[model samples]
Target: MNEVYFPYFDPDFDKLPERINGPTCRVCIDNESMDDCTVVKVDSVNKQGLLLEVVQVLTDLNLIISKSYISSDAVWFMDVFHVKDEHGNKLTDQKVINYIKQAIGTTRETHNSAKAKTYANMVFSPEPNNNNEHTVIEMSGTDRPGLFSELSAALADLHCNVVEAHAWSHNDRLACIAYISDQSTHTPIEDPNRLASIEDHLTTVLRATITPTPTTNQPNQQEAKTADFLGGEGAVTNVERRLHQLMHSVRDFEGPPSRTASLPTTPSDSESDEEAGMKTTVKIESCDEKGYSIVNINCKDRPRLMFDTVCTLTDMQYVIFHASINSDGGYAFQEYFIRHLDGCAMSTECEKERVIKCLEAAIERRVCEGVRLELCADNRVGLLSDITRVLRENGLTVVRADVETQGEKAINAFYVRDMSGNKVDMEFIESMKKEMGPIALQVKNDTIRPSSPERSRFSLSHMLKASGSLITLLLSSNPCKYS
Candidate 1:
């Protein structure tokens, strides 16, 4: 009889002891295979703290988490750790299955991330002229920890050169297109069987597709770098470098780049534009579920432009806070709130309107800038039922919904709307609230107060005329005078 030796994780192992002290540990149970790494979905009421704790736990386990993606739905963390099998072979495994179950019980948490959010409605096609010079893989599913890196590692093991890749996560579902070519040998990965095997391996670990030949080489290198970073060394720094270049491209607001829609050929009169620049706030209210709602403000020099920019937040229902007019005669500042009653879906009209509005305000165009959107809400039965009624009566569609709460306060955020611009009445808002009670209050200036009934009319009407959903929260004006 032959005896086999195996290496297991030391329960008391302490490398980064500070990371896994006490309740702050991300421990995975019952996973030993390299290909079948498990993902534990931890949805503690304390999501943020729980996420931090999980990170610490992985660190304590001496595992290297490649990416920790946070979005409106849930926190997705991807990691890799060196593990020794019975044969003493170092291997990489995705610890997603049982690990998630061990931490959060058997209940499967929703898979939503900025990367793989667009799981549905995405069309993948094979890149033409593939006479064996390239291999394309369009993989998208729930964004899990190490999905990309593990795939890249598998590719590396097979000695493939990644030529192009693009990926984005909306609600933790990831969609990615990767183009690969055989190592310097440049061997054509043209075998259908080979392609199927690759896809099978990817599906096993990533739970994503491995399609052959898709879309011409409109390769977004930034996405490739992101995938690389999530997969291994020097990727994060490289991504940071590119981000720095993008930042330098814009002259102001070293913050993330703002979305700018193409300017209309028939521009408004110069004098009128200047007047639009003078207005400090553009309050927009639209009918959602209850009365109406407000979105965000674009503080660029043009108030009208900010108004148009409201189309971008079409996904969420919110109320307008204020869009500060900039002194530069361009779009300067913008703010808005996601409302409880506004419809749950957005229209193309809203998207275009917001884009045009932002352009009017003076936001410059750039490549690969951060997309700004917000969803803040805790789960509350009373608030949701109220908002739901308004949405149904108006025939507004809900594209996305998430309820997240921090501290003791609850925030309910929804993206919805009437795409065809159906008329939503005030009676509907009133009736909905009467049945479900008052809409939840938004916290402002560190003080929280319920929205008044009259205010709902103003808030809702303003939201109806709006284009984008208001995701950016307006920081309360400082009442503290400077010394």
Candidate 2:
């Protein structure tokens, strides 16, 4: 009569109203349990990507997830997250808590009634239209040192200004989203001819030398093409989420390295273990009794790491059944129990390996290896172009970039290295600060870790072809559950 389950969720979850007929969400916040962080518990009817949606709500608000637990199986689901503000203190702001409820704790009768879309069905149609004040440009292709600079220059020449932009590169694949407007009128370009022209120019830049021979009709062999979806800025699709989709569309996890090889050379086992030491360790195994594939990961802690991992799993069509997240001693330890959307555990060795490859690629995509620079200046029509041109001319390569606008000011962050993949010269960086004005351009993370900068290099193709497997050990034991 006293028996108890070790990893407990909500025992009364089955009795919640509308548990069987519709999606119901109940989110509770407890601030007294932990002094350093607030504990958030969410119980709801399960759906595909439900975990990702919850995580996205918290991450978008810039809250830090210190630890958490997740369980979603059969008809019900429950998740607990220990969270803190950016200052590492438990959340105390009432306004932020209310917003989190509005965002993640709403019932979804509509979602319960509608069928979920498959990966193929989710691709944005390439049709061009004038639907918003700015034009949305989506692209994916092989990344090069100055590809962004080239694209910015081309757009500038076409009388378009990039007002907001995000670019991500992984495994030599580049995924970019830019909201552009007319340079002169500062509005969406409506002329059919101009839109056509812009698409053509971007396709050329993306395809340059990577286009396949004229004989292939296969979708997998198709070169990168511009997909124009004119829309308001971040109104419908989450821009960052779409970036993940774009990279997966191009099959970045399996493709060969591009000519320029955005990632540095993979180190040989004999070269040094330092580079491998920094790798995000991943292991996947199946629990047949529970019908779930458990994934365990250990890695150096970083911002948004959980979001990136969960995003990959969701995009890969895996549903999380249970999870535990913790961070200590500057390292992250996470375990996820998941299964395919159809409710089957992964069965094949190949399947497990693919999951590992995809997870590793996902984790490394956001890890930049060079000096991070932040630029703040008054917004201008061709501001992005000017900044990118400066980087290109200075022999620097932007591995990652985040561009946004606030009020009348332009705020941009760039992760840059030399044309060759190595630590940047401080003297050159100082010169750049002087050129761009010291107060306007500041070095945020100037001290790049030199011990194993190559660990930041991630090209799935290179990782496989070089050593034939990932650097992480594959453990067979399940990670211990959080108390």
Candidate 3:
């Protein structure tokens, strides 16, 4: 008999045997048949995180996906994505295609997985004077899993409206360009302070890092510290084991796949209408098993919706062990198996109600409100600080921000509101545009700073204020990112 080992009990346990063998995943790119775009097709065994993993690889390659079709039977999955390079041309490189195939074909071991290291570099700038009324944001960085999704969530958090976007990846580098507008004004952003906030926030997101805390103590404290660490670790392990047992119990109760084969072949009339409208709905219910809850969500599909939902759950301090997601024809259906972050189940009525209300609010906030704007210009140190100062002087509030820099050029987006919590009017927007015109021109021209006494004093003060403001903004904006 084959020996089965659990990683929770033995940290050095070997992973379970692979279910599929002999090159189960396949990928191919067709450029000749598709006139303006490239068609990339993938076939692989069905498994958790399979779709997300494939997307991460494509995003790293700097390939823009214009359209995608995803289908999965119980045993196998197939996907076809219509794509293009940043320049909107079909892919011509064979080596790049092979790299994608290899990435998707390889099977990942489940245990002792290590996080990939990523380095982020960015630029911030303002769009050039043109008849077009939108600003542009661009970004390039080392690609990692969920990079695109994190970018989308950052943009949504900033209240920036995405007017148009293009993204591509080659090897380990990913690049993206987006044309956006202020959510309040529905025009290009002119307030410098708001732009600065957007740049700083996005830069922080791109360069975010996680480091494990080291345990150190004096002689008197060593014993206590060691005991505490071991106790906490043991508690976590027990909770995880219990959660896994509960999942298995529920699945067993549901019976084998063949048991559902005798069910109805088609949905009723009412069910069809509900699915057709594609209205957003969130449902939370207690699992019959102890220490678990089931979260069911049905909604209109949009970019990064999955990431947004997952982010919200994490913010609410929930641990998710199992999740299934399906999106088809602009509608998304998702189910999550969850418990409190501390491993306790939702046993109280009030807890369940709070979960429902909070989730609904999170979804509603993203879908509604805010004006979007975009900025493109040459990036410089302290540029974000200068821009944010201007916005504060004008009494504008930043609702959302997304910033990206590639080489020396910077492109950014911000969704903002006025002091009164309302969309900005045209007159205010025009005034901002006039004030920002000279700044953009100077940055583009690389004008030398005047060396007068007054100029030196102003520069010193500006640096101090920038440092303080950056710290304050990071601490206050979107606590969920840190949590």
TM-score of each: 0.23, 0.77, 0.40
lDDT of 3 by residue, 1-483 (tens): 999986665533332233335446677778777787888888877754455556545644545555666665356777777766645678776766666566666533231121121111121111222314666555444333334445555655676655544433222223445555676665865567766666666555554532223553312110000001111213111111121222222222122223332222233243457644666688888776655688988887654455446545654667655566666666777777777856777888888877775565444333322334455545544344344445544555443445544445455545444444333443444344443333221111122222222111123224434444221111111111100
- Lowest-sum lDDT 10-residue window in model 2: 474-483
Residue pairs with backbone atoms closer than 3 Å in model 2 (clashes): none
lDDT over C-alpha atoms for residue 459 of model 2: 31
- The numbered model that scores best in lDDT is 2
Q: After superposition, how far is residue 311 of candidate 3 from its true place, in Å?
A: 5.8
State which candidate has the highest TM-score: 2
- Candidate 2: list runs displaced more than 4 Å: 1-23, 107-131, 211-235, 255-276, 436-483
lDDT of 2: 0.68
RMSD (CA, Å), candidate 1 to true, equals: 23.5
What overall lDDT goes with each candidate model? 0.33, 0.68, 0.47
Q: Which window of 10 residues has the lowest lDDT sum in candidate 1?
A: 474-483
Mark the regions of model 1 whose C-alpha exceeds 4 Å error after superposition.
1-133, 169-171, 208-483
lDDT of 1 at 75: 32
Write candidate 2's Cα lDDT for 1-483 as tens digits.
Answer: 898768777977865655566547888889998878899899887877778878877776567787989888687889999998756888788877876676676433322111111110121222222336677888777777788888888888888878877788767778888878888888877787788889889878887767565675545322333444412232344567778878877777774455455545565343346546766889998798888899999987766778889989987888888899999866899999988978799999999999898888777777655666655566766667776776777667776777765567676766677786656765554443343322333344334333322322223223222433222111111111110
Is 2 or 3 the stronger prediction by TM-score? Answer: 2
Q: List the candidate 3 regions with Cα displacement exceeding 4 Å.
A: 1-20, 24-280, 285-294, 310-368, 434-483
